[model samples]
Target: MAGGYVVGVLTETDNLNDLARGIAAGWGMKEADIPRLAQSLGQPQLQAQLAQGLQDFSDDNATDFFVIKATGTGAQTRYRAYTAIQIWPDSAFPVTRNVAGSAAAPNTLRIFSDFQCPYCKQLWDTALPEWERQPNVYRTAHYQFPLDFHKNAFSAAEASECAGAQGKFWPYADVLFDQFSSWTRLDPKDVSGRFSTYAKTAGLDTAAFKTCLGQRTFKASVEAQYKAGVALGVRGTPTVFLNGIKLMDYRSAEEQAVVQAITSATPSAASIIDARVKSLR
Candidate 1:
């Protein structure tokens, strides 16, 4: 073992244990030998082997050979490989953030998301239904990420969070993601006016939302979300955290697989989203 720790070989096979054992056996070893092999692969002693393997290659050619390939969840995998295990000391959620069900209900599963991100929309539209259907599962919280590159992103984030002040965060988020394509296609100069129209459509007080945006009431809150992302080493849109587990590597896996990874560590909670909404109301 490398430093006396077993290295897990994660795979996509449904019969993972069996596959792992078979692979080990094929190498003329026991199932338990897999971890040892992984550890050896990472040990300092293996460096000489790697160096010898590249002895005949030029510097540039050797560098090309060492380039890491995207295996599973492309961006998510890259993010996780780089940022996992690094803890953020300063990241904190809003005190009044959405709560899960009462003591009778399950704990909250807060999600930090940016409305401008297509991946965020995908998670919302696709994987969310499975968790929503699961009893005693999770409650989601939305944090704003108006990426600097997307000119209209900040306004949408501000609008959604402003709606949170009026007890309509999720509804606002839904509308923003649902109409994201249309909303973002508008001229940047027209974003504010169109956002106001969206707020009204979501049954929110358009005037209050406008005031909140004008005063930059949620600006610091928005910055805090970005800071949390930066502190956690977020480099792209749709960076999400399930409980405290940040899913930066999200490729190759389907929605159900992703959900399973998050839910694996927590017990299912009853009607998490509905309960949180009721709590907000």
Candidate 2:
């Protein structure tokens, strides 16, 4: 999408630059009406529906969003690539949600993940630690997005929040990702027992953590976090935003991406997004 308008689209675009050629022959609809446009372009036996609504870039008035969809055909599913030129405000990175670093830190690493997800675990086990080691460079926030198929995922997220209440969000999250195999295979009720064991490793007050978990103290907040991830166009777990530009599509996050973003003197993602937003104006 260029200048907030759908110039051209593809099922799987081979050359992104070619999309610009579309304006000379417009698709004949207001691009702002994303859903209608998306549906009309639906392919044979496949359809695109706006899965998530538009989300605000910040607390400010202007909004930036992606209209992504999953086209289903019986047992098969496909993802349609769509880009909407947009802005991101690091100031609105949801600090009050759940954070592992200083809210006011210079860089933001926002993650939406499911406890049962292997790639999420891979990111947590390797890349995340490096982000943390960079001293004052990053402020990481974790957003819960336990996919429905992962039955024990929500319970695990609630456990992490309970641990967070005791000032141990990162430590407890570490245990969950690191030891994913052991407890992930267990039933939902048994997952509670697993959380207690790791809560101890995270140095939490086990009894308090257990009580918090049992009472479902953070259930609503965890669910709300998942909803927020969806509204942000997160289609799967382990979706990350580095300085608020999505870090590749789902399951493609790599440590090298973080390394390059932090080391380069290139303008921050927020500034890049600001430029795109200005172009739309």
Candidate 3:
């Protein structure tokens, strides 16, 4: 088995306890900090196991290493690794669904999403809270980017927007996602009746909401968002942007880098690539 393994070490650590304290204080680093780690192991594999724990070490007190073996036939392969650091800025969030953070901690992270998309639901129900806790990091703005393939997306977005006009965009959006499985499964022509029920369940003025839906009152607003999404290079559902920059996919190392980048506020070039990559994942 002619192959190679990669290991990372923190230079300033004297012992395991020191390492633990450094991590707790957010001063400790990760394996990806090592240069060319991704080039050697591909990004998906890199993100999958970046936080490997050291099980056994010869000098436990003085040793701090994270090793990853590359299984292949290349005895003469050169070894290299690079680390990228990011800085996040503290700024006032001028816009958000809720204004809890100020310029000292900007809370704005705009999301371009389609209510009918499953991945969007996953992001909203799962990753959103993690980001939400960092109120100083970003305030989120939700936009409608209904996909054409989804029969009910436009209607659903308009409904949510109308709900927003009533001061309930978030709640309406939540309800839409909660009911997505049922609504998306229904036949397109038969969906309005179910949508009416959803609106009622979401605490909309059922009659007026139904009337608006029947007349497609908010359709133009939804279309406007669609046009805006196209102009911004959004081709699918669950597209996200931090400030004005598009985020990468969920499974990308770049995503993890963006997490660190957003948390810190100063985006390194590599971190920006990671953010955009996470969007694809």
Candidate 4:
């Protein structure tokens, strides 16, 4: 078996730079004093100490040791670290719907989004297309987390769920997002009728979809997903998790960062222990 896994370390220096500048100005120091002070303080050594401290804490807590890296130059350098702690077990998220990519793909990108949210729609339109292009690597699992402020979002979520039951979740979702403005401002009572039209457009059986809609067959499922998202600390729409790790952002640059994180995540020590024990048998 491999030895202890190394976690990648990342650092952001923008805030650190600002703080350094603020401190320098407070001390009435020249601009050159900043870099000089940083070198004299042994920034690299301090970063190493911080990384070791984090590693010790993570080891004591039985969590994976992720990498720590410093970003920025000179006195503006900041240390950022990430730990791949296994919080939720695999069984915690059994609900997988609106999947895109190969069913057998090893990686799962879980998304908690509201159908009517413009940001969620933007994620779908911008990030998801590029993400979906990586079919060989991962599959996307959509979960509904409709915000309270969006009046018709919950109903739209249910409609997508019902469409999912008929094997049209993705296409139905595309239509829902594409025509978001057209339906969001409409009368609430008329939303179902519009959903039925989208169902037909998405190649779903409209009669069956209407029957499913009228019955509210998947309402419980949608509500359950929302509750699950809440339980997992999802406070808003377009919250995304790659293999259960929450992404800080899901936009253009952040999208690639997410992919890199998912692809590069080191297996936990617990998993390593389990595998070793199994092999001994």
C-alpha local distance difference test of each model: 0.53, 0.64, 0.55, 0.69
Query: By the lDDT metric, which is better: model 3 or model 4?
Result: 4
lDDT of 4 by residue, 45-104 (tens): 765654343332233222233333455566565654443433345566647668889877
TM-score of structure candidate 4:
0.64
- Per-residue CA lDDT of model 2 for 248-275, tens digit only, reads 5423445435433543435543444345
Lowest-lDDT window of 10 residues in candidate 4? 1-10
Tens-digit lDDT track of model 1 for 58-95: 12211101111123232332100110121122144544
Ranking by lDDT: 4, 2, 3, 1
Q: In model 3, how large is the Cα lDDT of residue 268? A: 41
Tell me the TM-score of model 1: 0.56
Compose the digit string of candidate 3's lDDT tens values, residues 15-110.
323333333233244644434323434454542443231122222221121222222223432222121222222231122232223445543455
* Cα-based lDDT at residue 261, candidate 3: 47
TM of each candidate vs. truth = 0.56, 0.64, 0.54, 0.64
Judging by TM-score against the true structure, name the best candidate. 4
Off by over 4 Å in 1: 1-108, 248-281
TM-score: model 2 vs. ground truth: 0.64
User: Any idea what lDDT model 1 has?
Assistant: 0.53
Residue-pair clashes per prediction, in order, are: 11, 0, 29, 7
Question: What is residue 69's positional error in candidate 4, in angstroms?
Answer: 28
